[model samples]
Target: MDTQLLLLLLLAMVLMASVAQRFPENSCAQYFQYVQSGIGSFQGELTLGLQNGRNRIDVRFSQLGAHDQSVVGALLPYPDEVTVRASLRAAKFRVSLWADASAVLPKLTRLVYNNNELCRASEYNPQSFFNRFFELHINGPQSPHRVAPTPVIHKFPEGQTDVQIKTVVFDGSERSISHILSDFVNEQTATSAADWAPKSPAITSISSSAVPRQRWPTSSVPTISSIAPAPWKPATPASPFIPNGIRASPPSSVPWPSFVCGQEGTGVPYIQRGMEFPRGRYPWLTAVYHKESFSLAFKCGGSLVSTSLVITAAHCVYKIREDRVLVALGRYDLDNYSEDGAEMRDARRIVMHPEYSSRLQLQPDADIALITLDSPVIFNDIISPICLWETAETETEAEIGSIAGWGTDENGNSMTRYPRVVDAKIATVGECARRWKVQKILDRTLCAGNLDGSGPCLGDSGGGLMIKRNNRWLLRGVVSLGERSTVDHCNNNQYVLYCDLAKHMTWIRQYIS
Candidate 1:
């Protein structure tokens, strides 16, 4: 062989031995060149990678404990910089070379020729001084690193102390070191070293294949305090009227009515009318009505369509004595009968809305009536008449409507007697139709209620169903039978029907005229 070639071969062999002596038996050594110098120290768990001319490292750390915590990142690697990450807890470390071949070759050549040669010449003996010297040069110091022992003190009753020594290494890994330290502390106590060791507290074993068993301590059994017996009490008697075995009276806060409308008959519509004036325009709108019964009594509410023509529920005038029927105009105050106010007129004749039927078994949507007063009601601030029904050009549910008369609130309790009016928005025909399922809510008569729980109730029967037409209120429906029952109150259930006036508009106009 040539002299120069032999020298090269000998140099390679020596270099291999030097490399073997420096690293651990399975250590991976690779030359890495940083694209840029002066990278700051980073402390976090991370993954390292190289892309383009930049070294990228993703660092992760919990900002808080297991719960209620967040993680934030900072200072991503820029171009031409190498990245390395070390995780002491997980025992992981990574490095990425980010420079070109020209920048990395010099470091690789020096390490291979010098370090490898020394390791091979030393026969891979790490303990040898010659091998150690080369190992230190190539890597760093190999002295057994020492850390101060951490003393743990656990306090028991009567000031008894349990002291333990804990050691943690910082060679980029701490999990295994921590576990070993814990085991040493637990087993090293004087009490645990006895030949007949005292059994530990009961520990419930949890296993998938076997039923868990509770292990009890053999040394001592804990004492438990005895509890006293509870005192006996007598039970109260319950009322028969209330169901569910409850005898409690209804809440006093809500005043229940003495008489519920339609309790004796099919039902009564709860009519609601809008305020005659806007807010602050008529302060009296907020005034509560006092109850007063007219000498001549009728079972229904009526609308003064004409000076003499009064439209109402037919059932109100059915089989009623003429003397008992009185037209109470401006009868807003129901409480005081003697209070000086507009006097009511007696009806000369009663004309039911021609379509109004006493024979038709009352369902929910159809009962209606009309009465002709003996004298015309003089329209005044106190005795204003509502508009008569006109053929509805647009009878959609969205068309705003109102119902007005004396009726009860949701609890079947009457709010007023003579004429208390409340108003509610009309529901869409599609919604009302689907709700009531009665084919009756159509073009002529519309349905109202839903929002604010507005609808006709007891005593509102024969009252006026009015709609807002060009900003004017027009009579659209008559208060008829309601679907009696708390469950159907306020026309809440789509099945409960109210009177539909449009169906009898032609008959109403002909008779009233």
Candidate 2:
């Protein structure tokens, strides 16, 4: 496997241990926003984007980690996905999504395995799948429920679409599926016999030809009209489902881990999986270094958006007590400037947003700034400028973007000597309002980060939140001030504010040309 995939597996293993309490809630949920926005019953399988971050863990049988797992009540783990197909055996449990908990409950019949009943939800609690809420049941192997069914595969007939699914009764109480041979069965007689089973929560069973027909149940079996229902309708126990990968492995005895993004406010959490960025992938990420500190320290980030312009936060230059602030780019290792091919330039002129005063910068449009380089930058595969976002529609389809920088934590600490890249997802204005307590998030302001605990750290104050469009990266937002929740050097869970470059393109064009 590739290094990234191997690293991803390792990180997933680690997250398996600690994600319950520390995983960022809603960090990777953009893909499911449409489901939350739409009304009515929703049934289907979706691979929600919980990427990079350690994933949904089965907490039913293991140790708990740092995330907010307690709130995962209703959406616990249910057998909603066990569609009543031709081969469903009696005693297995499975998990599936249901828009309305109450509506699906009446349909859940007891699951019987090895002559023992399993997974009959004894209790339930509500959970938020996104903006909408859901619930799962309290289930386990040791509960009043029975043992896990040991699956034993048997050869069944396939030619000409003839298959016999039979349920056998043993000792007058227990039931089990007896998969009989299907090759020689006749159609008309089999159809007449199938009329004995229930239409919904259907169970298919065919007795041996030697058994008397009087053994069949006389209950009416309803047949669905030949007409197909709308494609997205919720799956009934009687409906067939397009196969999916979710919950199909490791058997069905374990409880699912929570997906909430709650974590302790320790140093910003590490990147979802702490995967290092490939060299030269993000050439525009620049380090804005200060001279007076002499620690050779840089606490802010900037983007080489044009040949002669390095865009950053106004507060970055305003707070610099020193006269010199150097812009360095085109290399990974920040400590060794002579490493391979790197470039450093002096700021020829500093231009702050007209409304950007240092005192008020923490509040509004006062956060953006630009630096004019003394010389034009030489473009290369390793160092290039990004495109500006210019579109009639301000809204973008992208929900997540990456931020790059050479920055560290609250105490000026760093895990890597090289500049690093991390992902941040765009959050709603309401989320920004909650994160930034002191100032309101204006229409021109933007917020992003779960960072999987990676950044928007102190040193990345002026970095760019870049979205890839067409085939090039576009500048969307510029790093600005933190709401009090994330002013620390590294913020893992809270959203960070940015000055929306999409709203300031006219001003940027005026200064750049």
Candidate 3:
């Protein structure tokens, strides 16, 4: 009740508030106590420290009333992390020390937070069930990065045993504690099914390791059982139907388009029962024609990427005479040459990816090509270039990439009148590799299709594999190859390969603005 005592209490409260407001100039730490209740009770503790962008983590886990244990302690670089990979057996685990953590933290933070209570439980709120013991906020403004809703991590099973993960932190204000906790939740609760899925190296360390799995040593430093795999590099693919012959071209030159690319186009609304894309639906779709004696035949598909540039599969033009090729932009119906929005351009030059080869069967290696139009094509509502995909991250899991072209349809018949457009589910890198038995599929090729006979067919070569984002269509891949049917047409039962455009950005930018 004395004045001195009241003043001392007020000062103490203010000091506590300041500590919660911000960390010291370059040092901070946090601790967490993880407890899981039920059948097999579990308890653990984690400590995290950050100083000068570097991270130090120490974790100890024990099954309640039992001696079974697991511990991970490591000092990681700014963008590195410690990952724990366990198989069916709880003890059969691979603890990778200092794997690349860059992919795991920043990306998850940028995702749009959906109203998922379980995932929200992974947040770093002090009052939450996960229990955040302490946190030190950075004094500066919060990060402004935002992204679309990312996949949410599911919660642990209820009842007998609850897995509680406790983590401590130090100087991790730049990288918030919430992001770190979310990453841990994802790693800890991953299902066996996800083990086969293609995930970023930071999340799943499924690579050839020099070290073998073994018992952990009774020491402060966690033993490293594996070295992180090098980053996944994009590979490429090529068309299969084009005949081999020398393609010729004159000294090529053309002006670039002045307007923006990848603008939305107006056409008939999507009809679930129909596969035929209406006129003006895809302004960038170009029918590549092979000039025959006094006539032209639709040979392949192409995409208008710029006023002067068209992208297609390398095998479509490789070794084929460029002079005999004609590119018709804004064309929809293959049978009618004088459709309202059709315009044909001469091929001034043809350039295949330097690494592309026609001899490589079932391999889509460097399968992209660029064609130089003789002159700049004027843009209209029905004739515009599509934007190239520029996202650094790979396509999201189960995302759909659309294919539209004059490929053959069901019943083994050619689409002689109009191009067909279909949405195909993009397959993961591991799925692609396993289906085709080609490890090189990881780098430059993307695999996508439906086993329900719904995908690109014969003559769909060189067509664009497009994905829409922000109301604009982005070119993600070029149709390359797939299995052949017993009748020598496309095998719709398998996934098809396309040349991943992201891998060839450096080469593409040299030719584009």
Candidate 2 CA-lDDT value: 0.43
Best by lDDT: 3
Native-referenced Cα lDDT, model 3: 0.49
Clashes of each: 35, 23, 43
Question: Candidate 2 residues 451-508, lDDT tens each?
Answer: 3444456566787887643223567888775534443445555676778887877776
Candidate number achieving the greatest TM-score relative to the actual structure? 3
When sorted by lDDT, best at the front, the candidate numbers are 3, 2, 1
TM-score against truth, every candidate? 0.40, 0.44, 0.49
Candidate numbers, best TM-score first, in rank order: 3, 2, 1
How would you encode candidate 3's per-residue C-alpha lDDT over 1-513 as one tens digit per residue? 699999998888766543333211111112223222222222232323222211112121211122111112111121222221111011011111111112111001011112111112122112111111111212233323212233553432222122222122222113321212211211111112110111111101122221111111122122223333333333421111111112253334432212334543332001011176444457688888888889988778888876668998887777777798889887766677765435788898888888887865634668988888876554443566677776545644577667878777666565546766777778878987787786746478788876666678767889888875533567988888877766646776688888888888777666555
Q: Is candidate 1 or candidate 2 better by TM-score?
A: 2
Q: Higher-TM-score candidate among 2 and 3?
A: 3
lDDT of 1 at 77: 18
Q: What is the C-alpha local distance difference test score of each model?
A: 0.34, 0.43, 0.49
